[model samples]
Target: MITKVTHGWRPGGLVAYLMGPGTVEEHVRPRVIASWDGLDEGWQPDTGPGGALDFQLGRLIGALQVPATRAGLPVSGQAPPGRGYVWHCSARLSATDRTLSDEEWAGVARRLLDGAGIATTEDLGGPRWIAVRHADDHIHVAAVLVREDTGRRFWPHHDYRGLRCTARELESELGLTPTALADRTAARRPQRAELELAARQGVEPARTELARVVREAAVAATDPGGFVDLLRGRGYLVELRRLPSGDPIGYKIARRATTPIWFGGGKLAPDLSMPKLITRWGQRGDATERLDAGVLAETRQTLERAERILRGARQGIAAENPDGIAHAVGDVVAALGARYGGALGEAASCYDGAARAPYEPVPDVGSVGSELRTLAGYLLRPRRRHRDDLDALSTVALLVALAALVQQIAQWRAEQGKRHQATAARDAQRLIRCTAEERRPRRGPPRPRYAREVAVDHSRRENAVAAIT
Candidate 1:
């Protein structure tokens, strides 16, 4: 079975919508958490002997509405059959050993459901919590993120890497198998390279590294185009500009490349200043003149420092203090007089090594973003798979490979047919040439045709005559 999980900010503002919608009107009393234990049959009083049918229907609808309740941020409101928000999200269990019976599978799911329910009360950070079984194939758990102290909805302004980490840890505690976790990890997109680079550097780089790299390169570049092209070749995007009014007016120069090269999710500070390049090339002053004196010196220092820190990170210098590397990045950016973009948290989140960096203009060969992201996400939600989990993942891999093989064979056959036709045409041409050079058929000396070519022609003639007769 496939296992996957997806999470993000609750769209459309949770609290307002769920609390506002009158669907759960009868049960929307302002209690912290109202129980449906006795109220199930009451909600839809119809012909039922023991209320079993009513209870089951209520449970399904209530489970579905947990997310809605969670979205609105009012846990006090009732999460009746069809009005709860699905907050924490769902997770699937992968099998490895011999397949268990339907009853055994249900037992595993019940335990997961129990774990999720217990986790909801015990680990009360995210919103509403739920665990659902898809027959015996999988389990889906959804939990809300809310303030435990005040019961107010908590909206995360940025992407929370910590949430993913929490998910991984919970999965592991729930006894998910490694192979199953691996499969789940593979499904998520890889983290950004810049973050990986930062983690490697011992700490994440400050937000300004992207600009500094471009500024320094632009300053020293005799040909800005050539320099930008070089950076692009290295997977960087460079932006050129000009100053319309400053002392450097009419000056053409290379400014900073795009900030947050990858994962430009947040905003930038308005006051931060950057060098401007003239729109019209060869406007007035020398391109070098457009480069600010202080900027050039500072850019050089920043670039050198960035290089040193990058080297240190790669060498695992600050493994003990992840924050150290992050701080250093912040310092480097400040020293270069660069502003942090709106994506600082996202950028910082990327430090987890699971986020995909924005597409680099230049790609670093041999990089593994997906693998690292999987690891990073795994760090968040670890699952300790049982033996059966491992077997299941292997089975899945085999199935995938089998599917790919079928496709490969089809392609190979098409290519082989083309090759066979080409060989036939070549043999026909050679035979024609041999016939053209022939003096007489009876008692004649053989011409010096290549031995292999002669054999191929003879084979073709024999096959042709056989087919005709």
Candidate 2:
């Protein structure tokens, strides 16, 4: 499903546009699916003697604007910009999905209103809203931003997040295509206008592309100077938000374009914010060091040591804040993705959300997480070709071990009641395992693990992906 939200100053105009003749987006028999008053029908005003559908539009418009008007606002005049007294949301189902009945759309409308705290059952003071379905696949929800009981303006907090959260549940219950849960720190999504613009320009949305570039740079960077240089080397227009004393505080980047759109690190992800990055990279002090790529045996040993600490250390990840450790682990996975971009890259990107810390900054504080951060740097450094039997075996073992580590994190997340993170981690694990199974035969000597196919749980995931071998 696709949802678009906007604030409008004119509630009557919005209501008219939604119910108007199919001028832009096609509107079939436009009818109210749901409303604040819980009316099924008959509430709509009858046409006047002039025979125009819009003749009695004022009747309904006046009704919708009651709360706003009572709150010292004009009856039909527009409010100031950005302080629009109306919230308009348009929701459309995928073309491949089945058409829902009016009753189902009503339920969806009610759920969305309640989820966003715009309205709730038995709450007389909530905002007055209506869901109008003008087409087979879409509905527009119009709401007056005033409490009916209190007659005071009410601005919703985290409305988009709440709407999407409820959307995930609705998609699942309605047997529609499932969307990835926005259950991590990186939850900024492109708006419908942005998506449309990107489509027209034949390019990725600025936000999405910049996020990937910034994240990859963050993983590879050794220090603040190196991080800036890395982005500059990639030809991005980089600028820093600095303190009055000339020390840098935050940063923003833009891709090379005729007119560039700059984004701050926080806009990309909470952890990617400048302060968080500085705090994190500052701890891993060796800025110019690189791992010995030829030492495959030593690499395996390092991974083994990481495994032991991850599995059995006295002050393990869970004892402290696990976000830092999760962030470090995700960095390693991201480096691997950058190293081999293909299906592996897809898997890595899919898992990115799972690795994010919450909105709060979590500096990679402890030694155990520090070890993983070091490994991440090692992976970011260039690797030599694997030749001898020991090298090939070690290389293969490293991939398997890394996959196992991801699975372990997934299990830990599930145990901790992070359903979305757990699901994302498991999905990444499956994809990485699948990539290994598919590409290993061509790359090197085969193992029994790749020869045997494992059964996948169809109940858990809907997509038909390669099974872990």
lDDT of 2 by residue, 56-133 (tens): 677678888888878976545646656687899888898889999989998998888888878888787788888888
Top candidate by TM-score: 2
For model 1, state the Cα shift of residue 138 in Å: 2.5
- The whole-model C-alpha lDDT of candidate 2 against the native structure comes to 0.73
Q: What local distance difference test score does each model get?
A: 0.33, 0.73
Scored against the true structure, residue 176 in model 2 reaches a CA lDDT of: 88
Summarize candidate 1's per-residue lDDT along 205-246 as a digit string, tens digits.
Answer: 434444344433332233445545655665654444445553
The residue ranges of model 1 lying beyond 4 angstroms of the native Cα positions read 1-88, 93-126, 147-149, 155-469
